[model samples]
Target: MSAVPILGVIEGFYGRPWTPAQRGRLFARMAAWGMNTFLYAPKDDRWHRQLWRDPYPEAEAEALRGLVEDACQHGLQFVYALAPGLDLDWADDGDRRALAEKFVHVQRLGVEHFSLLFDDIPYAVDRAAQAREQVSATHHVMDTLWPDGQAGLLLLCPTEYCGERAAPSVATSPYLKALGEGLRPGVEILWTGPQVVSTEISVQSVREVNEILRRPVMIWDNLHANDFTLHRVNLGPYAGRPLELRGLVAGLLSNPNNQLELNTPGLFSLTDYASGKSDWTPEASLDRALEVWLPAFNTSSIHRVSLDDLRLVSHLLYLPGGLGPQAVRVLDVARALVNPQTGAEEREALVRELRTVRHRVITVLRALEAGPNRDLLFDLHPYLVDVAEELQRLIVWASHRGEDDPEVFSYRGSLADRLMTLGWKT
Candidate 1:
């Protein structure tokens, strides 16, 4: 309902960057979802980060040019970002010139949007002095590349880009204040809310940052990012960001799960929220997303089990307290069946439902093993195997109620240990 906010995706994770083919696919998807921007800032790319002063090799440059053309054809802005803070010599003009030249090279490849990142670098004891130097160095590059403010779009991610890292506090931090005042008016700044992976981003928080920056802050939302832990995959829908947030900033760009397929639901849900869909709820949005997602794994005929259950038992692994509605339903049925007072007919019915759930999970697992999305299967494979084992143990325990079986106890303990490693509650 709110004017569609500037929605975009940033491939800014720390792990292996997405392949060129994968990136092309992402651009097509972003276009379909009405996303307008694509930021190229992968941390592992040496030319983008460590070798920040060097130009891209011809082969790589040609590939990037094709990607930029693809993005433009899809009506997406390809923002080429460079992380020069890792080893940039802020005091050296030659260093500044090299940085400017890199941008110029990218600009020649039809990239008009640019970003300079100074995140994840050591902080100086003289915070204000360092902040001024960083701003000055960035301005020098921007001015050289697009003199007199002719740059199409320029974004900066300051070293103290988030609330926790902003020494003292955002309002009182001399470093941030310097950035706000020293940076040119046309340059946009990127801020990750409160923390790198904030659970919630309130309007008041954005307002405070906006006041200090004297401009609408471009948000780098890490809601679905998983590079911090390989075991985790944040498939949850985009919540905690209110629709009113559209009015508070320049745009919202999410750093999503490393696995491209897993990011679809959250991305779609974000688009819906930004588009003012009044009926939007993370739960409902996830349901609609899975309706399309599950079938891709060739499990469309597996009946009576919902995607919520599938996620809880599988994809939602590696996060604490992550049981989905289906998993909960199975747990409830198991508990009821464990009661000695339960009638035989009711027990049989619960057993049938449990078996159906188990069967569907197996069907999904097999399909994944043989499907094109098998890499995703590999990521979720451990959780799937454990869930299947747990279900079989549960069914066996229920069938022989009140029996003291040492094997059952051993299996239960092993399952508990596995769940704990995956961040699930016992």
Candidate 2:
């Protein structure tokens, strides 16, 4: 039940960054929960990525300075990552100097942890050359600033950050091999498992990368991330990682849901998962997290939501590869209800169960609208409403015994529907 060295949250999504207030609250919570890092690299922060060479404006600098101070006060390590990979010319010395200057400016504000991310960049045919340039560029900046090798928590997210994204494969990728040979001693690497949003991170996979990187890899876990599909949120437990994984890697940092309020269950469950639990089950872990999160759903209005309802909602949003227990049960009934071979008695049972699910979903939607925590309500509304609608569709199909009307959009003035059919996505 040992812990990974870098256990914390990462604010690195492709949308509006969390507010300073939200970040402050996160630092406090992480500090109390035995977590120790917070990576600040929101993609929409122009200064952090698109304008990586530019110094922060005085007002923004002051705000970041204060955030760094707050992180220090809470005993959490603050790491700032620059996504200059979008357009950095690694061969140019001036670009290297700009990188140094940006980090130095933040360093003056008492920031020590730093990372240079090369993910999501344009791929070059000669990936090894790209890897070599990135390694050299990072060294140039580090030599200018932390020549003594005291670069606190230095990290590099290679262009081929995961096995799936790796050119060819992890072991054979020239880019990864170049990084293994070239990264300066003590600089840690950030990997996002086999895929960018991995459903699992096996110990053997970590071992393979470790040998290739010539260092123990630190995971940038994105299991709970939902920025790509904003309509869906993952409010489930920290899972698919075994206790043995703690021994295989340098650290783990979760890049969770973009919506700050929706991440409580994930963040809290992750903390509990790492708190030396010998027998870790995602269900028990989430139940513990929901116990802490249920109060936020208790509106001042008499329409209160319960832990069971939250659990049901979590099932609906659940994991990437598999559904939660309750969700599985619901899907089972729906599937059975649709089967022609199902007995009449079994059909009655299935229909009864689905009606119960329909009732809970409707009641939860009503209670969510009466929320005392308006921000939480706002973040969850779309997903909850969508679930309710899907359940209603299932109920209608059941009532009709599977002979449903064809879905049709009249060609008269419904231009959007016609336009949608013009694309390959349809």
Best by TM-score: 2
Cα lDDT, model 2, residue 9: 91
Q: For each candidate, how many residue pairs have backbone atoms clashing (under 3 Å)?
A: 2, 0
Q: Could you tell me how far off, in angstroms, the CA of residue 37 lies in candidate 2 after the best superposition?
A: 0.3
Q: Write the per-residue lDDT of candidate 1 for residues 1-426, one digit (tens) a residue.
A: 435456889999999999887888788878887899989899998999988889999999998899899989989998999999988887787887898888889989989899999999999998999889988977887787777665588889999998999989999999889899898888889999988987778899999998988899998988788899765676667777776777888988988888876777778777766775656676776666566566656643433335655565444342222545555677788778777788989988887887777777776677677776666677667656766766666666666643545143544556646555352212
User: What pairs collide in candidate 1?
Assistant: 1-275, 1-276
> How many pairs of residues in model 1 come into backbone collision?
2
Give the per-residue lDDT of model 2 (tens digit) for 92-167: 8798788889889988888889988888888898999998988998787678668886658888899999989987
Worst 10 residues of 1 by lDDT: 312-321
| Poorest 10 consecutive residues by lDDT, candidate 2 | 403-412
Which residue runs of candidate 2 sit more than 4 Å off their true CA positions? Answer: 340-349, 400-426
**What C-alpha RMSD separates each model from the true structure?**
4.6, 3.7
Model 1 per-residue lDDT at 23 = 83
Q: What is the C-alpha lDDT of each candidate?
A: 0.78, 0.84
